[model samples]
Target: MLDPDLAFGEPVDDFSHCGTGECRVNTLPVLYRLNQVISESSGLADALRIILDIMRVSLRMDRGIITLYDRRSDTIFIHESFGLTDEERKRGIYAPGEGITGKVVESGQAIVVPRLSESADFLNRTGSPESERRAKAAFICVPIMLGKKVLGTIAGERVYRSRLLLKQDAEFIAAIALMIAPLAELYLIANVEKVALETENLRLRNELKERYQPANIIGNSKPMQEVYELIRKVSTSRATVLILGESGVGKELVAGAIHYSSAASEGPFVKFNCAAIPENLAESGLFGHEKGAFTGALAAHKGSFEQADGGTIFLDEVGELTLAVQAKLLRVLQERVIERVGGSRPLKVDVRIIAATNRDLAAMVERGEFREDLYYRLYVVPITVPPLRDRGSDVILLTDHFVAQSSRANHKSIKRISTPALNMLMAYHWPGNVRELENVIERAVILSDDDVIHGYNLPPSLQTSDETGTTFGVSLESKIHAVEYEMIVEALKSSNGNVGLAANELGLTRRMLGLRMERYGISYKTFRTGTPPRR
Candidate 1:
């Protein structure tokens, strides 16, 4: 007897010796074919197509159908079928316990009919054929059971004259259904995970696209405006760009702006830090290697150049590359091709190069440390990112941008910076540049207790001394006034003692400037060549 959860517990007398006949030979080969087909298939639809085709040819089963329960719609719909017209497949849907297929799925058991036409529960939903050949066939419907739950049903029809017994055929189909149950469940789960990952990837790409826009660089200073113009000019061509700047002055940010705003923005943007790789493996890291290229090389690998094909490759600290690697890189820049570490064939690539370095490549070339040929090739388009000190008032703009970012990230309620804190930030000489400014602001945001970022929350280095090496160790209010006084004095001198011009340059009204000057006992004429008479 079959298991109680799988079928009715009754044995037919005539079919008791059916397995001894042709059943064992035919059923064993069909199971082997099912395994072979399922292993080669990558999708559930293809696997089911092969499984049903094997049943039709080897077991003489036709009109095969597989239906899975749709939990969302609360119905069983045909997922795969063989020997059915297109119109018939479209009409194959049943609610639980509504028809023979639905009944099997609902009952968690099997149903077998010796003559499909004689069974009152058989609903021939498939379109009519010329010979009415399906009406005279025997039918078998089996629930695909796992433990106690019925996941789906598999059913098929065979002509009555076949040598296979109905009971033997029913058991064979049920065993195959049991084998396919786990595989179908796994396929469904994998598909869901793949969709989720794709959605997340698209979101990240959009974020990168927006973050690298020229308007998003956060500066209105003349130096920054020049950098923006250079970015626009260089983005129109495919020439190699060499970015010169101190460390942490946003060289990578400039690289991203060039790539995403260029014609090749739709293509990939691959980044590699030349200083991060080991000297011995630098060649393999830049140019991919074939399988068994070295001790641990088990498979073919694509290096940065190949990965960045049809796009741009940003090599940070390109000055650190050894002479041997530099010689190979020169070949790539000259011919747009690369040879794998262990392979003889040279593969052509269409990558645009954007290399950045803090060191002077000209000096390196003079010393013969860096190849002169590569230096000229990369120097075709050069853009220098100005350090933090050169961009006078951009520090306050950057500080506010970072404060807002850190507020949202850390879930703080910081809204504005106190005047004293802003004064200190503007006075410091940021050797580490914009990157360091962002770090300081993020730290201040985290440490700040009130909604406003006060002087006490800032780092000690920024607060103690000004860029001119002058120390203001007084109270916070007094230090703020001192920094204000110094800035006013410098502005007045630059304006040649014109109070109106000084006020406009300092982002202040003339009346406010005069009031502050009188309070600080500063006469505009002392530093200027000649003073304009008071209006």
Candidate 2:
């Protein structure tokens, strides 16, 4: 948490710029206080409140809410807010498909609307004045996830005539997600760990890791074949390369694939996400830092480049870099030399770069947001990981793989899925892709007492995929299967919907999933209801 703030600096004029240097300098004071709240705030509630407050002020919005994925309800709740009456805020519960925020949560993507009245994804559950929904300006909602699991979201709504949240805002928010993400994880992990300790006999932990390990990248489909082929081709290349794909598309897996199969296979394979690092220390992290480089620089430090000097440095989200750092990276790429921050000489390094990002750097470059030269540098040999929806049978193939893996790890005898569960997985939109599937399977593995996994154990998302967006689970059918739906249904039937113990029953892939009961019955309407079948 503190780390992201460290290298990222205070993000002076971070996302939205007013005028040139002068205007940005003036706005600094106000934004500084906002940053204080966002970065330095402690405790989950305080942090969330601070975030909403900051957004409300910075964006000049009438309302802002930070809804974290509530594990207890399997739904999203407006945990904190700015510019909303208590009466309305209290009614913040969002079923998977309830409204815009709900749908965005269900779809697990950011949505921007200049006018809600004209949008098809609008959900109006809060009972706010019609003007709140119809008012001019933009409403943007984005998923807040730490790697695979989605915690909740940060939504901003400007009052009538407010400017819309642009793609840049969404991208910036996406880049800065580290702020709320870890806290959400901390909250979820705390609950998980507590329950895990209580369910001493549960073997869900190992079950999850094994299923999501390098081996779980299952697929024989043409798209998968193409992925494998690209992985193979890139594996042999010494050229710097880039991997592009959405979250849960397994960019890291592809990173692993490239490393394990490379000539430098024996060499260390190190990974780092540029966006995850703080701006101030980003350079020192990627390169090295000499003693006294900064306040806490206590001693000399070797950065990632040096640590993996003889191997590969996988820069996940490489485009999150600042232009200054991009320039440094350019030098490293061209000269294979890196100078430690605060040091004089450039150290020679023999490392290959495999950059990855879901964002479009080329377009950013065109917009003068990203460096054109750096974009060209990273585009040397690009590899694409298609989303699960486009991968055909890869979903089933991967599902089968995870089920078996989970079964063995969990010490269960389950061999396969029942037709309904299989069909549900097949028919499901898989917005969260393989990662979501893995979580669902893990849940099902524990819930399944018989040889076959049943649909009843599936998460509400998978069980009702036809109705709403499943929120954060993978839409990429190409990765893992939904283990949550079956498990939740089974747990509910057994424990009678007692969320706590039910979640404790197992752990599977979709490693980032939390089975909050946000119904996916409708995204186009707030009048919809979430009706999960009773076990």
Candidate 3:
């Protein structure tokens, strides 16, 4: 019988036996057996046998049964049992809110009676006559807990009552139960995560089905969102948008969105990166190339601007276009018209222009590198996107998002990044910006052999042994020292062994550079020549 003090309501701890034999020696062996079974077993069936083996050898019970609570049916059923034939085991299963087991579950406490005949709740469906006789005999039933939840119970008849079932028996059972809780919890959590990951993957896949979907643009930063919002607003209108950002931040996606949402919603959305186009054929490509327009112009072909007539044309890296090409583009924007190369008769067509550039065209205009009038024309409704490093919190958010995404893409199941890997990601400055961050995340996800992405898998840029920030915090002297070292190095390299040249490179007079070098306690000769100065 279960000790009242060691009932299912409390964690059984105090172990003292009325008399010791099988119950005394069974605890360690039962635990070891459970470990062996769980290690060998793969699924629920194996898990049940693992538990059953514990009961058979440890408790010396005549028969043992485990019942799992069915939420939908509001009852318990036999997941599996031990010490009975397969048919008999199946027969021992009982409904919840029925029998002593059901009452124990409802009550949330272990109930053991010395005499089963006296118990009113004992609705015993005995396996056979022999089992029936055993059922009238003595037994112990304790709730199986996966943490605080009652998964079900372990119940059986004592084979031979040589010793009274004391606090020790319940303590040993609870020990096994306590150990099982964590495993069960892990199984439940892992299964839930797997399902959730799969569902998210399916949704993302469906989004990519359309020729144009917002999901194609991968960024969660506020700047990126602002770009998306602007695209969404003006997409329905005939108003043109000129995207402005560093190269590789996905400006074409914005243009695609504009086209998909505009009056020419069903029309084609063509893209042409201006910088990628050769200077010789730039105009012909913007307009159309007639047969023999150039030596390689084998046949008449429509350009991007013409192909996207009644639709939208995305002009990426527009700042790279030559002055001649810029003038033609200005004319195209001024009037919705395009002329095929060598063909006269102006081809008037309705087309929207969406332009993007990484260069500061205003500065270029000041330097006469780009046209001033064309700059004004293209600067209309400019949307500038911030670099990845500037967008705080978006880095890790996008990292997790990409990890989940790439995991599905590569048929992998990476769960998360290790702390060191995450620390590296957070600390490192992404100079290549969002595009670089995306590439790194994709690679990390692919290279992750374990569920956790470790620091070893991180790109070399993040692997700098500069753990200085963590230890030093913010020190003005350290910063100044680093800056001083950089300046000296620059001066030395630019000077090329000449002190005057080094001094001129530093924008300091030779006399001043010599004085400064002396003050810092260094000979100019030692620095220029790869030799240490005498102290």
Candidate 4:
């Protein structure tokens, strides 16, 4: 609400500008008051309402309305109004070029209706009474513009007066509109960006949910099926889970699947590597420190447990915790509470613990390296993730997944792995497990130039023969021959076993290619039949 008799700052003494010898309005005082209102207002909506009030009071305007354009709906609706009921304001909606206000917005110009009764362009959409409509009321609308872009329109009504006075009022309103144009544009841009970011955040969360689902874990081997079953059963419960696996066996993936599929899927999933933290800082890292807890502790920090409240926390390599930290961990497991490093209060936490370790905890217990009570607490539901060598043909499935993934990431067009490459992948012992297989496939994808992963594209370690136990004796000449053999085979495959075409692709004469094929025991007939020749 605006005071009807609001003072427009101190009065100016000059009154000679008006030919009638009366100073009804001063532009400088009104402009200063508007600037003060704009600067003191909290936000765009607040500022707009007060601005319209200022115009209605200072300019003696009977009614004022500010309409903003909504780009999404392609409609202009009254955003702020002065001297209009809520119901009347709700009725003032129009499209661009629909009415006088719309025309001002569409043309990016100011419009003045000298006589509302005589003008056909006046819609009277606010449902003003017939008496007011028929009275000598004038309407003025000015487009609020940022550069050439029209954001909306500011319209007001005043008693019909001389043409010069109406024109002067329109100019004053247009000047105020220009002053607030930048603010309006900034508010609109911020709102659009906020909505866009929220939409993107939702999309990424859904993608993560789909990517980490148990069914999407990328393995169908019996061992993997068992792991999946255990994950499904324990996911619905709040029991502590212990995942046992050798290094690089994807214990972290199993933990993630459990967390995202559980009831607390929307909560945070925090992962802390116990082995990555130093032994001295282990306690403060697991259970956060107070602001002045240590020499360098500058701020209070929330540890993995507190940060994972109402969620799941994955403690990888849990066997690496020292005995003292293990005891504190045991207390947390039993009491569901943790004490910060230098804080005396025990904070309650509702996090589900999923611990993973490559070491044998039972053996560590016997050797007095790990606490027995803590081991039993963690052993409640032990899930052992099998090494890659034991997963059999699942390696082929994982290999295909990694190859496609790496190809897309590296902007390559890898069609398929060659038969020899597949054979090499299957024959490897995979001591480094699934992680190693992904690295191997990524390496092969990077090295492949002909859209096919050949045996020669693999690293030297994976090129060992079953009988020879080494990769072609590590000589430069042997490596060259290996690459040459792969290239010749690939050329034959691409040329559909046409000797002359294959020879041409390999930059060799027909006779020379025939000699080299014979030396490498390569037969083109098998390639013609779409069967890879024996190496």
Candidate 5:
């Protein structure tokens, strides 16, 4: 008889009473089936339920239950069970040291109750019937542990048998617990990461909603307002948008605005550069390929169209696609289906197409460079984004936006762009458009020494000679003289009126330096008095 106060029953460790041959015969097949079930199961919960079922069937256990400890709640609840009603399973909750199941978890040891009818520790929380409570029964429970940490417990009840048989059964249950510890731990970790990823995805979706709003696009110029109006009208529909603009003119940005503002905002927005894909792989890249379709194609792939199934796909530089690829794209536009490389079945895709190009697609079609049918299909709603040079004072607005962004990124405290720098930015013809403007601002912010972006911080390409009023075709001799004059002035300021020191700095003799200064009308006497001579 077990002690009433020690409700944990008996700890079963030595199974020597059970012969080795009997143990091997009974345990080997169970272990093999458990391995097979675990390998074939999709998730931890499913695997655990199947495992409990196996125990009930093979070990002749009347009931089996698996419980997991929730650190957040500081309690153990039935995670999986067999031969127990839903109500009974829900009643099987326990805190550490609360019941026999809890005691096994608290001590991280196996427990065997030889006779349920006599043991006072058998709580019977699941409400066993009077007849079953009076019947001969043996209960076995073992802690499921990962290393030294107890994660949960597994328990079962069988017909009361010989003590030797109960010991053998307890040993087998303990071994099963050991095998599942790693899986349970992995399931717990995966659940945590899945929750974190869901939170992050929600945050990003909200941010995109705010960021890609049509009103958020910078520029109120007449051209931009017209572009905004077009975006608003077509954003609610499923029409194919053909964005016409020079390279780096924010065509992709406009496409993004349309996507996020549309009804399909919750779906993916896939971007593919038509000119960037290699010619030989372009079809495979867009339509995907089956495993063993070609060399090095080890597994099946999902292409851009399939990936953007219920969403939008922005095909930039669409005019650069080869004729063969153009035909396939035309078929997709017409039939709404795509066939993988070396695949016969056509996979249907519901995707909104948005194509952009800097080239003249109308002329390309005439010259046989682009497909005529595809050009018409993409031209459903043509939007021409004006070049930056054409959008007058919008330059100042964009410059301020870029400055603020660059300042925060580079950890600078830039207050404003100097008047001269602003003038240069407004006056220049931006061949690279808004993209080039952003790069120039980032460069100036990194090179700036103080709170202001000066004219000198601007790239040389933006610098024009005041005398010639032009950036190009300046005389070589004039350029040399301008550079020399600045160098000599800087040298004098550094030397503080010491002619010999200034000369040494410029790697010139004192006489040569003095002669050049006289010609350039620079006087070292002014520098000696802590004043720089004007050029």
Candidate 6:
């Protein structure tokens, strides 16, 4: 709110124009009040409202309204005003060039009507009563502009006793509107940008939630389907899950799916890698530590278990726990309580433990390295994540996923993978599993200059994993069959999809060539149509 006293600003006693008896309307007071309104306002709406209120009192204007233009809609509507109901404000919308006010905005000029009844363009969209409209003698409307861009309009009504007074009022309103135009345009731009950012934030959050769903885990093989079933069954209960798989086989992703799909999905999911924790810090890291519990322990800290009090705690590489820590963890699993280091009292924790390990915990227990009781407790809900080599055609699915992800992250436009490159990817024994595939795809996306990933774009290790002398467990018979199939397909392609010509080129009778095609699942006519050979 603008202070009414600021507009008067201690009246000037010595009048400058002394000859005339009629006193001049002092505008210095209005200018000072406008300055205060701009400086003391919190937002654009507040500034415009206060300015309109102050101008009404100083200039004896009535029914002051401020409208803003929407470029997408090509309309101008009253945003803020002194004398309008909510319904009336809604009715004040006007298309560009529709009425007198619209004409002012479309032409980027001001309009001053000396008699309200004389102007046929007036729509009376503000729904002012007939009595008030009759009392109003003059109407002044000006375009609020930023450079060549006309942003909106400011309009008011006043009693018309003299044309000179009406002209003076119009000039004063136009000057004030010019002063506020830039800020008004800035406010609209900032508001549009803010809305866009918030919408994008919501979209990304939804994408993250969908990514953690079990269906989006990216594998369709029997092994992965079995894993999904196990996750679904176990997610309904609070059982202790034990995820077992080779390194880089997406153990954490499975755990995340379980946690997010479970009954306690709303709770926090905390994760810690036992192998990454040092021997000295394992105890405090899992069970927390009290203030002054050890050297340099100045403040009390919540550990992984405490942080996951009502949720889930995923302890990766649980095989690395020492004998002493193993005993404490075993007690926690059985009793649902953990005592902090250097504290005698035990605190109850309602956390679900989802433990993972690449090493065989059963063997470790037999060797007296891991506790036998803890192994059985965690083994109650065991889930085995399959390695990449065992997942068959799922390699192509994962490859496509990683390619799309990497293309987006690197701002590249790679859309497809060459057939030879895909064949190499499928044949390689991925010792590093899915993680390695993702890294390879990211590297290829960064290194490739074209829209497609070619065989040469792959790292040398993957390129040689299949072709290096009886490597990758591909049997000699299988390789011979593949070579035979390729040679026959190429011969058919060269002979323009003629079976007899192809048979003669391969040194075989037509009957033998047909039998080989049936054995290899090859279709001879597909060659001339430019379809890839199926085998």
**Candidate closest to the true structure, highest lDDT:** 4
Per-residue lDDT tens digits of candidate 6, residues 388-408? 999999999999999999999
Q: What lDDT does the true structure give each of the candidates?
A: 0.79, 0.68, 0.66, 0.82, 0.80, 0.79
Clashes (backbone N, CA, C under 3 Å), per candidate, total: 0, 54, 0, 0, 0, 0
Candidate 2 per-residue lDDT over residues 1-535, each given as its tens digit: 1112212112223333453221223434654554565566465666665565556555456777777665555567666777777646655666676777777667777776655666776665566787644455557788887777678888777632212224445555555455668767776666764533423322232333234334556777787788887777777789888899887878888787777667775567788889899999899999989999888999999999999989889999887899999999999888999999989987999998989998988889988888887888889988888888888888888888889889889999886676447667777777777887788888999988788877656776665444333323445441134444445455544545444554566553222223234431211121122233521
Model 3 misplaced stretches (Cα beyond 4 Å)? 1-221, 465-535
RMSD of 5: 17.9
Q: Candidate 4 at 187: error in angstroms?
A: 9.9
TM-score for each candidate, following the candidate numbering? 0.55, 0.48, 0.48, 0.62, 0.55, 0.54
Q: Write one digit per residue (lDDT tens) for candidate 3, span 308-385.
A: 887878888888999888888888888887788787868887888888888888999999989898888877777777
In candidate 5, position 399 carries an lDDT of 92
Model 2 ranges with Cα > 4 A deviation: 1-216, 465-535
Best by TM-score: 4
Ranking by lDDT: 4, 5, 6, 1, 2, 3
Q: Which ten residues in a row have the lowest lDDT in candidate 5?
A: 1-10
Off by over 4 Å in 6: 1-208, 465-526, 529-535
User: Which of the two, 2 or 3, has more lDDT?
Assistant: 2
**Higher-ranked by lDDT: 1 or 3:** 1
Per-residue lDDT tens digits for candidate 4, residues 1-535, read: 1112322233423324355532345546756766776676446775686577667666778889898776655667777888788656756777789889888888898877766777788888768776764567777899999999998889888774455556667777888899888778877787865534543454455567767888988889999999999999999998999999999999998999999889888788999999999998989988899999989999999988999999999999999999999999999999999999999999999999999999999999999999999999999999999999899999999999999999999999999888767767887899899999899899999998889998888887877564224345346888787777778888898888999999999889999999999988999998889986666
For candidate 2, which ten residues in a row score worst on lDDT?
1-10
Error at 22, model 6, angstroms:
65
